[model samples]
Target: MSQYKPENPATEEEEPDTLLMQLRRKEGSWLDWAQACQTLLQRQKMTPQVIFEATGFEPIHQNQIVVGSQVYEGMAKAGASPAVLEYFGRKGSDILYELRILSPKDRVQVAELILNRNLNADDAHEIARAVKNYAQLRERPEGFGDHPGDAVAYQAWKTAQQTSDLQERTRAIGRAFQYVHSDGARQQIERLLSTVAASSSGGSQRKILPKLSVFRLEEDLPRLLPVVGSLPLSTAAWEQQITPEPEGPYHLIHSQGQQTWVALPAWSVIQSARDPVAIPIENRLLGTLLNQQIPPEEAQDPVLLVVDRAVRQWQSEGFFLIDRAGSLEVEWREDSGSVSLFGRVLMAVRPPRILDEVVAQDPWQLDE
Candidate 1:
């Protein structure tokens, strides 16, 4: 057995010795263990590895409990019901750990949902992801309300909207109905399911948009003419090479003589682009700006910047491509200045890498 003592024992009330005794004996509930581990780490300035070596608690377990305990505390602070609190106090550390991804208020709502539905760790994970993704959307879908159930239903509904298969759409709608709490939302989902069932019964097929496709800049051949020389090229030069086709589906254009293309969903902004172009981005600072938008696998690789030359009016919230002394760069500016405005950035695209696919296929293989 490893014997460990705190370097600077503060007050007797802290009871560092008592906490250590409890941990050593493996006494108390999981919540109590978590609280003790957190206190030891935060108040005693003890390293997790040291605590692990002494208490037989793995460092990864320590991390989960510490974070889970904090989330439980947040739930308590958010006015979680007594039954919900009591249920989590003894068990559900993994469920609480997943709730850490949500806000305090969201955590409470999700916790109650978990308790009511008797959901396990995997269900908690799915609910947390659904709620987080729904919260990030700029505009909430019409039928969905601001409830945990509504978030999950909205996710299912969105999936149903993007697929053309009747059976798949019906399954998605049924899933939405399973989680939907509000009567209005349930009714909407039922209507959608009915339509899908009717379509499956040899009725007029419901019209649904094609599933959103990921267009790789490297894989998809470029459609638009390439641009040369410094950016913010004269109006005549841009007009000569690129023409506005508002009715057309293709929008991606590439520079640097590279035949790269990115197909975007029918976004109004991309559709209305008079002069669209795609440029390879190498700036680290720009990458930092777009870090949230880029996937982790493609973080180190150069991203494709798709921009529309038609919209150049400066806005505080908008990012624009500019001609900075013969060099082209992307910047977020508060006000327009002498810097030439090349175009407004529509989106930053990360091309799929073959290396990622190769590694994913045989991740455990050793080098010969």
Candidate 2:
């Protein structure tokens, strides 16, 4: 056996930390370096206003700002602000990037919270883990970031926040119910109803009561009657009869004589502008036919037959393609905008060249 030699990897052509150190020592310009840090923060969706506030870099010089690769690394290494550094760290690493649900405000809030040492990095992550919904539920309330509160309480409160006006009202009903356990339950309930009543006008009162009825608080129904008029009976009894039907492979609507209406399973449509495979065969055929790849008469039938067979097989086996690794195009919805969605359930087997081309091009585009 050969004697083992420890591997010593060569340094990268551009080491961001080294370059930042060099700039710091030689240039002696904190503003220039601060601007660099600002650019990096902006890329991570940190607002320019926040960065300027965090680091008091005077915006006096017009030509002071210049673009460079190492701004992020420089900013991160310099410890400009703990919040900024944590944001940089969360974004820079692959592990923390999964918190895509957290909006820019949520991120800034977390950064600010971190600055105050009210929230640890782990607590910040818990906030980010909540799924982004139609309701801007991730947004912190006015006084939330001001104090470092329990992570669980903050998460619950954020969840309770709804974006839609009607949903917000509905949520308030739920909160009023929850507040019953707390010390100031009666005050909270009165405040909630008062706010709803203040917002309600003559005609809109009809609409508001009906929507509020959607979220049933059986215990509070007696108290709510005077405010909301009369409560409708909860639909729980009838909902069982209309339990959701299963989605089968196919559905038949008509079976009479010649005329019939049958629906196939809704196949996912992928918008793959960059995929060569997605290019229409008719468009490609002209060039191929001109090059004499195939006779014009025979080209269409063989291609159509191959596609038909492949589709049939794919549907039958629940796989568009299969190999030693796993199946492809089986369970994935091509319409999904998520990049990590594929990696979540299965390993996507793609051609090495295609992967290389994807990696080499604009990196952000892949996420899209």
Best by TM-score: 1
The lDDT of model 1 is 0.73
After aligning candidate 1 to the native by TM-score, how far in Å is the CA of 351 from where it should be? 28
Candidate 1 per-residue lDDT over residues 144-210, each given as its tens digit: 7999999999899888977887778878888898899887788778877777877878998788766
lDDT against true structure, model 2: 0.33
TM-score of each: 0.55, 0.21
Give, for candidate 2, the lowest lDDT window spanning 10 residues: 222-231
Those runs of model 2 whose alpha carbons end farther than 4 Å from true positions after fitting are 1-34, 37-109, 115-118, 129-368
Model 2 TM-score on a 0 to 1 scale: 0.21
The 0-to-1 C-alpha lDDT of every candidate, in the order given, reads 0.73, 0.33
The candidate scoring highest on lDDT is: 1
